[model samples]
Target: MSSYRIIGLFALLGGLTACERPTPPLAAGQEPAYDLTSYLQEQTARLQQEQPPVLKSVITKGQPTETLQLEELDWEKELAIFQEVDLSRPALRDFYREERHTLPNGSTVSIFTKDAEAAAPVDRLQLTVSPLQKLERLEAVVLEENLLFYSKRNISLTAEPGSGNLNGYRVEGVQKLIFGDSLRYRVDANL
Candidate 1:
């Protein structure tokens, strides 16, 4: 192997082993302010370090952003008030999300996740809840009529608004989508 490759390998290994970050000390008698940004930065460094240095992404990157928080609305009770929707009509609908998962049994399972979108019958604020596993490209339409976007993640893909849309999305945790440009968008599906 070349000297550079050997050095790179060692560097990767060192980063991997040294990543158990100590918790930050709190100030005496003063409550520490919550800092989501710092927490996410720390998390990214650890994940990168822990994964084997191979062809980049053979290891799962997990959910986009680890952040992208969902908006809350009292939709279920309101959806119950719908006159047209049959109780049997599943206020929330599930579609297929095909993904590969590393099963507990040391196997990668190719499966489809149930992506469900639900709404309150009366209040009309819609919510899309996707399985944490294999959840991607979320969107919603009410009565197959009105459409709205509460939140989205991953911007690695292309985002074209007016002229360009959103591409890839990344989430750091339950608190944020790493890239948020809420102007307008059309995305390329080729990715």
Candidate 2:
């Protein structure tokens, strides 16, 4: 009987010892390190070192008979939007996941998709770069779910204009919008 009681006490002590222990607190002046930001900046620099991509053509299909195409694009003004995108910010970085690919032309394309729950107006964004990582082609599309803003306002993806500093790509999109019956007007930029 006494041996049995001793065994139970030992088991209880062993169980308590096996419980999880808290991590040791950091010492003064010691900071936990996370280098995701530095890695992203390095990748950006490597891509930018190459000649920037030139937009050959941009075509917008579908909508109220306004099929717009831009053959001659002002690289500076057109790309200005991309240059302003700041990915280093914690919120924006957490919101998008970037995937990069190398094309046969020796160029690279990087696509950033917004996380499901947090993604708004802009759902998908893409950038094509030269072999050396220069900007080549840029495209962004906002899904229909994000378009319906107001209860009475029905927005069209192909007919709405939007702008944003998408990661490193600045984009300016223009589309039209229709507000109820007998109230149709062009809406440019919803970014």
Candidate 3:
């Protein structure tokens, strides 16, 4: 190749590299908080490795409650909704306000409430940790509204107080689309 062509290619490559933005680190040191994404990821990995049987019950508007006992589950897919509410992202560092409280029962609670003006879907997240810092329960509310559709989800997860192993989870939500009737659904799963 000609020397000029080689130099131009290098310049183009450098420009392309400069245009690419790397994902910012989740921890920004400005806030002391629990890493929700990492914690959920660890739980997902553990569940997948264990392959525990799950009893799941689902109900949808206008439908009968259906129950299933499954020997295996796609843990990643099942936990996708929880993962979507990641509060640890750098971009969300300032989106939610954190409050810490100590209960009379010797548990600590961390609550993150999103700013009213923030565009993030995660509206609120509350986590209860035992005195030893093990997660006991998590509750979250997520809202998504746009021109075409609207959805609100309330999620709750419970873990064994001593083992910190997830024992059950429930998700309840309502969804509606423009010109359509609202639909409500609920899913409860026990491990």
Q: Largest TM-score belongs to which candidate?
A: 3
List, residue by residue over 84-190, the lDDT tens digit for candidate 1: 21111222222323344444534333332344553332212211112332212222222222343233222221222222212232221111224543332322222
Model 1 Cα displacement at 25 (Å)?
Answer: 21
Model 1 per-residue lDDT at 93: 22
Per-model TM against the reference: 0.16, 0.37, 0.82
- Which of the two, 1 or 3, has more TM-score? 3
After the best TM-score superposition of candidate 3, give how far the Cα of residue 81 lies from its true spot, in angstroms.
0.9
Candidate 1 lowest-lDDT run of ten: 121-130
Please give, for residues 38-59, the per-residue lDDT of candidate 2 as tens digits.
Answer: 4334434543553334323222
List of clashing residue pairs for candidate 3? none
Every candidate's lDDT: 0.30, 0.44, 0.88
| lDDT for residue 64 in candidate 1, whole number 0-100 | 33
**RMSD (Å) of each candidate, 1 decimal:** 24.4, 15.2, 4.6
